[model samples]
Target: MPIPSRAALVEHLVRTRIAGDVATPRDNNLSHYRKLANGDRHYWLGLELGDRWTDEQDVLAVMAERCGVSDDPEHRAGQDTIDPELTVAALDRLAARLRKAAAGKERVLFATGHPGGLLDAHRRTADALRAAGCEIVAIPGGLIADEGMVFQVGGVAVLERGATLWHTHSPVPMAAILDGLARDGSPLPDLVVADHGWAGCAAQRGFDTVGYADSNDPALFIGEAEGTLQVTVPLDDHVFDPRFYEPMTDYLLDAAGLPV
Candidate 1:
């Protein structure tokens, strides 16, 4: 398939529910913003939000500006949005970084908390980067983290517990991965492509990190707001079909000038 044009990509985003009026409820979005304001570190993903984001309104403002949610502090129910244009703009920015990584043959690490939804996207991007001369960083061993073992599968790291690969938002796995690399005397990645806590923990540790985020996940946007993250693309990270992401990723790679 050919890469989608910007207008076509925007249409795809809304039509397939990747952006626009997403499934995440307005109440749920506000609840997360409030929690982040209340210093619930879980909502912080992995960054230390501290006293800066104490006001829920402030958090909402950041989300609206970056994630394209509603800015109205009074209207707090029903449907919320992820602006397709903002999503596209951020995708372009993320692509810029990927392009640079490919050109420089930089070491890149890719991870995902939404394995069921985003693992394939990460894997595809990692493969492209690796083939473009970027070193696809690997986990040293099956590192135990948060009671689950981290394993690299199909070019991305995911946590497996029991017989199931788990979906997680905790930064412990990323912490464990970074620690393992250090212990093995391996050089750290020049760039990390990830979502959820994987991206957050890396940004908090001062890496050039870029990734996606849902309307409810505000930490990555806040991280970008505070200069901790390189970029954060606003979208519904998980949709009804994982296939919906293919076009978006293709749009990204296409924009980045990577072979798609």
Candidate 2:
């Protein structure tokens, strides 16, 4: 079938809303909408902006930086990073739009993720939404970086030939390790590796499993879950942190059958 035109898209959205084909619209103006073929609805979506795209976009620059993807060859030599600035800016933009929706007494559900160490930012965003009278619910089932959050299994230490792997986590360093193994052709060592939570659990299934640890790594991934009014990240603590706000917004809008 031919892709729908802009006007056609709007018509589809209106029809879906009227037919109740879309999920219940929140009480926010300019609410992001999503419509699936199976007729399911979601409040948020994820975006994928590789290395170069992230650097070019101001909103994603900080997240990319936080992910350790920068121009500095040393940091970015092997892998790309998510810019923290970009992630926050994207959230700010979304929050602004959501605020407008809230003004009109509409329900707004924005979704995204932040670095593990940046819990404060997430809390601040939640506070802002509450101030606007928009309900906020974060998806659960992951480990936070520090204590008070669920501190699971321990750390891992791998020493091979001349390479020493210490305290690595999945979704973050795991990818890095895979990349390193691929690019550098490094061999795995026979040592004790400890991981906790989902990422570590997943890794343990494939590695020489060690037990739990303190401060495994500084990354986590939440799944494509909807809060009362937002969607959180979907990876483990730090599986794959891609700074993707624009893409996520575009996706949710598209999924809602709204015009970009």
Q: Number of clashes in every candidate structure? A: 0, 48
Off by over 4 Å in 1: none
* Tens digits of per-residue lDDT for model 1, 52-121: 9999999999999998899999878999999999999999999999999999999999999999889999
Scored against the true structure, residue 191 in model 1 reaches a CA lDDT of: 97
Instruction: List per-prediction Cα lDDT, in the order shown.
Output: 0.93, 0.27
TM-score, every prediction: 0.99, 0.24
Residue 192 lDDT (model 1):
95
- In the range 1-260, model 2's lDDT, one tens digit per residue, is 34444444334323432111222212110111112111212211111212322222332232223222333322322323233333333333343444454454332211112233222223343344446554432222232321122211111112112222222222333333333434555443222112223223323324322121111111211111101112112112222222212233343333333334
lDDT of 2 at 235: 14
Colliding residue pairs in candidate 1:
none
